[model samples]
Target chain A: MYRISYKAFKFEAKDALLYRIDPRAKLFVALYSMTISIITFDLTTLILLTIYLMIYISLLGKILRKIMRNLLVLTPLIIIIFLANYLVTFNIITSLVPAVKLITLVLSMNIFFLTTSPDDFSLTLEKLGVPLTITLAFSLSLRFIIVLSKQLNEITEAQLSRGYTLDRGGLIQRIKNFIPILVPMIVLSIKRSIDIAETLEVRGFRTDVKHTPYHDLKTTRRDVVFTLSSIVSITIFYYPLQDILSLFIPL
Target chain B: MIEFRNVWFKYDEEGDFILRNINLTIKRGEVISILGDNGSGKTTLIKHMNGLLKPTKGDVYVDGENTRDKPISELSRKVAIVFQYPEKMFFSPSVEEELKATLKNFGLEGEELNNRLEEILEEFRLVDLRDRTPFSLSGGEQRRLSIAIALSWDPDYVILDEPTTGLDGYSRRDLTKTIEKVLAKNKTVVIVTHDLEYLFEFAPRVILLSRGAIVFQGSFKELLENEDVIMRNGLESPKISMLMKVVRRDGGGCGMRYSELLSVIIERLGCSEDV
Candidate 1:
């Protein structure tokens, strides 16, 4: 279950400051961070951006632990990238840059997702001029990921109770053990998908019709201030901050 | 025997405890029914028996070993749990294979394994469905198969979580008979359920839980006699028990079974009419 929490997209309805932030503002922050990470080749800028995202995530309080756990799942991939880069460049500093960049990218996305609920995310997408179908599809996919993972965990435990050892044996043997889990998950998911489609049909869901949304995204003064501050910070990091730091850091 | 010493559990560290300071001791060969409303921590309590979950505070000792010390597979040899919606756990192509896999897990092989497999299939009345795909079986058959798979190794303790959820009357009766057969073998049974009527008929000892605390632990008769406890816990007494309550209120003796209650009512009516 923890393995799939990163994709769960749960909405915590708490009175926290981060929870009250507008989804649109969070989304822009995510986009700006990603753009900066992608365009900035200098290591100093990437490191600074990574630090900023880390501090932003720390402010999330309870959600910070979940975000960290989700990031732990990416640790192996980050290490692999670091090793691959080191093998090619034979320089420790250059090798570390790609790992930092990957971390910055993931942390930025996590900031958006961990703080924003699925409903808010879809509403943000809808307000951003995305078609309703695409937004629905996105939300539905996120929902199914959590559902399927839960089903998988249940199936795994069921087999485990029957004396099946999933963690034993070699890699191929472990994959073979997962057959019992995967088969039921796929079958159940297909059955669930059919049920969902039937329910949608019964509820009069039509792709051609323009539907009225019950909840509309509203931006407050906080959203404007947050978005502007994020853009400004990104601009500073992308333009002058890296050059100023480079004089002393030797990057 | 299973014992929980001041167990407290919550999924999140800072979240309110789901099972709070739960202290219990379940003896061997005793059929105990855990009754509670939703979110009362019934499921969380039973999962401790098999080491699927360890206590956030205190300890869960199975047989004499702390559950925290052993893996679930090691604990499973003694405690088997058939979860609610057990059919969703089925992954085998055929019913026979499912039971076979469980027996194999317990290291049973050759003639002994085959004998146990055949015996459980016949015991659960799944002989005809032995070759059928587990998913293709009817709901009752699927549930029976799930129980059969759990019992293939003949664990000393069997836990059923809401075994009658979607079962029809006939299936429910069949399940009760199956449970009776298991009890006849003297295997300790623990059932977590909302089916009070079934609990009234089968389980001798009832443990009522509310908000992660055990409010009552006694016989069905004691539970029936306490209207305040039953009503407060949001539980409806069995129909026979309710009738018995009405009879006792009018100065008639209480009876747990329908036949006994009917006789009491007839005796009361005859005496009143004669006067």
Candidate 2:
């Protein structure tokens, strides 16, 4: 119902500031954080990374609650990680370090995803010389995430009218209730994706022949600034010997 | 001309047949309006025209040529299909690009493309919104853009599935004008609509489909004369037609044309022509 108000699955980086920055730069920052978090297993390093992520969310992004809501799926896994570390590790410090690192990585991923729209990510990929086919596939999958969420609600409503109940049911019963909704949603998503792919292929998107975009995607100076800053941050964080830190690194 | 011979379709092998043994033909320069209930395979029947969905049993022919032997790009050049929901095709941002994408894909360029595009844009009155984002347009604007894009290729046959949906009175009126232009040019137009009012207003030959078969095929006027046929087939005559029947039953007047219907009202209401 709200797809239109939510821009109905269109180019909706509506926050004026968000739109000003180069899409490619935002994409670089997302990727850089992910890479930096994964390379370090030290507790101090992980904490510093988390602090940076927290500051970024609080200052630059201002999407803390929104990211938390998106990370709901990872919450249980996070709990499991904490429990597993408690039960399995000999060194409390060692176990906690990897756990913190993983959490930082997950949080960084959330920020990256939150800031960078699929259009930007694809543009970045295209610039990186990734094949057009792979970039297009990645885009469709990302587009499906937004489209399917809206569809899932409608399917559930239709199922409810048809005597399928999800209310007050135990785990098994709820699982049974989900079958009808999931079957149609996934089936329709796959069908529509293939249908759209066929439409694009017919329109000459997948072929080697060059075609102009219906909408222009200009590479702006902000994108350049974003790339330089991210590259500098990534270099500093990647090298253990380097002392490059945030000027406001809160030392 | 469009022809469907023994066309059968099922969603899957294990599923019930959605369309069965459908044999029908729509001749060139003839307007056909299809009316059916919700699950009466209205969309499924027309989706075959553009090769969006292929027949599971037999073949569909466009302009006397069998579609099974032709690629969709070739078929698309002859048969332009407007979907039930026009918003689904709105992948492009602006209206100009939306129509140009069709021409571009066909490798059309230069002054020829620009001239042809400007002509359609003016005819449809979408010239003002040529550079505006398609997604940001009103529902009516979107529907009109859908029609304009379909006409961009100038296909011999234009198929519209519920074109007036989500449109207001003025937009619908302009679209009727556009439809008349298509008719004047002798292009075959196949409209799938349950709007009996429009069917009556346009007076196209009606083809009523029920359970994947063409049950009635005749002029709209002749079909409305049979009460039993309309009732049995879950169809209703337009409000104007029903009103005309009530007036005709009272032995008042015998006016059939829309102008005649209006003049009949003028005479009955005692309005002087030169007053």
Q: Write candidate 1's Cα lDDT for B1-275 as tens digits.
A: 99999999986676798898888999999988999988899988988898877888999999999998999889998999998877667877888988887777688899999999889988999999999999887777888888888888889999999989989999887898888888999999999997787775563688999999899988877887887898899887667676766888876544255445656777877855333
Interface RMSD of each: 1.4, 14.8
| Clash pairs detected, candidate 1 | none
Instruction: State in Å the error of residue B264, model 2.
Output: 4.6
In lDDT terms, which candidate is top?
A: 1
Best by TM-score: 1
For model 2 chain B, give the 10-residue run with minimal summed lDDT: B250-259
Native contacts recovered, each model:
0.61, 0.00
- Per-model TM-score of chain A alone? 0.86, 0.73
Worst 10 residues of 1 chain A by lDDT: A1-10
Q: Estimate each model's TM-score.
A: 0.89, 0.52
In terms of DockQ, the best-performing candidate is 1
Docking class of 2: incorrect
